[model samples]
Target: MIVVTTPTGDIGHQLVEKLLESGASVRVIVRDPSRLSDSIRNRVEIVSGSHADANVVNQAFEGADAVFWLVPADSKADSVTAAYVDFSKPAAQALKACGVKRVVSVSALGRTTPLANQAGYVTASLAMDDLIAATGVNFRALTMPSFMDNTLMQAAVIKAQGTFFSPIDGDLKLPSCATRDIAAVATRLLLDESWTGQEEVAVLGPENISFNDMADIMSDVLGRPIRFQQIPLDAYKARFLQFGYSEAMAHGMTDMADAKNRGLDLGVERSADNTTPTSFRQWCETTLRPAILD
Candidate 1:
């Protein structure tokens, strides 16, 4: 059985569907089973609880061949370490106790750069990968840059004002991926059992494109003039704080954006093996257009 955590999330839900399509026996650890469609709940064994719970994961991991692990973002956590590393501690222990063979996890890019240690959430995620790797299970950390679909969060604003914002420079070209591609890659890795040992799989999207380029694509696809706005890092953190995120978590996000701006993600060179197929234009056409227009 292949166990998946956060099965209701954007990437996890897609991964579950792909796994089912591939005829893999699937089990999912979810907080609420009602969030799953009736069709999905019928098809997979459901372990209704947080994967961060020791008993829940231990039960779910029993007799499982591989696992798909993702730590849900906790904006209210006291610190980045608490959000990623500490939350994952229970599952790391469960993996060893249950003897799971393989794990495919969602992580961020920037492990090799000197800025990694100061990259906040990315730093904690890398530490989480290390904690899991120490357990000796065959592990693949799918490291990625920002997701193009994240733009969907500003769909309403874009439709109303024809503008989007971020702390990253509008002209600083950087790789951004689509979550569907990430799910597709995770599905492929979970289905195949031959690969062993721990490694980071960099899922860089087809090419590096800046926010200005993305705005152009959005404008063309959505039939409106959309623009990119670079907000101050303090303003970005303030937005998070306004949403009730703790101070530490807010700083973590600000640090991550700052590190990205400083070339933290540039540590890895793009290659055919690591690059994924989705481009910003294609994503804007298929994903962003609908979110803004419909």
Candidate 2:
């Protein structure tokens, strides 16, 4: 049996679908099973509970051979990180206690930088990577680049202002990719059982494009002119604050945007396996458009 956590999330939803296609006996952890689509709900063994609870983790892993883990955001944690290391430590111990070894995880690029702060999810994510490694499981941490889907948060702003705005400068070519691509790689690794110990794979898109190029692509795809607006950091903070982000999260996002401008979050330019990912233009044309239409 294979276990997956955060099965409703962007990567996890796709991962679950892929696992089902492979004819695997998959178990999924979901807080609210009723919210799941009929298709997914009918397929996987549903284990209801929070990822942070040990009993939930134990039940999720009971007889599983491999597990895909994710420490996703929660309603109460001021940090988007779910005390990531603490939450994951128990899961790792339980995975070991269950005598299951093969594991794959979703992590971020630049897990090393001290500047990434607590909400600096990259840092906390890396710590979790190390923690998993120390547990002696055959593990792979998918160090994914900035997700192209995340840019949709700007769609409302883009529609309203005819511009995409961020604290990330329009000219900086930070690496990025579709979450689908990251999910593909993670699912593949989970199924391939040949690799061992601990490994890190960076999900670099086929190319790095700037917000200026992104604007041009959006315009071409949407059939309207659009431009990039570099919002002041304070204004960006204010915007997130209005959404009720804790002050810490607001600053983390703002600082991350500023760091993106300075190339702090740039992913590796090359992949070890030589997998070329979808370009932003193609991702927009093929994947994002239909979602926007729906």
For each candidate in the order shown, give its overall lDDT on alpha carbons: 0.94, 0.78
Model 2 lDDT-worst window of ten: 111-120
Predicted model with the maximum lDDT? 1
> TM-score of every model?
0.99, 0.92
lDDT of 1 by residue, 181-262 (tens): 9999999999999999999999999998899999998888888799999999999999989989999999999999999999
Task: For residue 4, give model 1's deviation from the true position in Å.
Answer: 0.5
Cα RMSD of all models vs. native, in order, equals 0.7, 2.2
Model 1, CA-based lDDT: 0.94
Q: Cα lDDT of model 2 overall?
A: 0.78
Q: Residues 251-280, candidate 2, lDDT per residue (tens digit)?
A: 767766666566555535565573446889
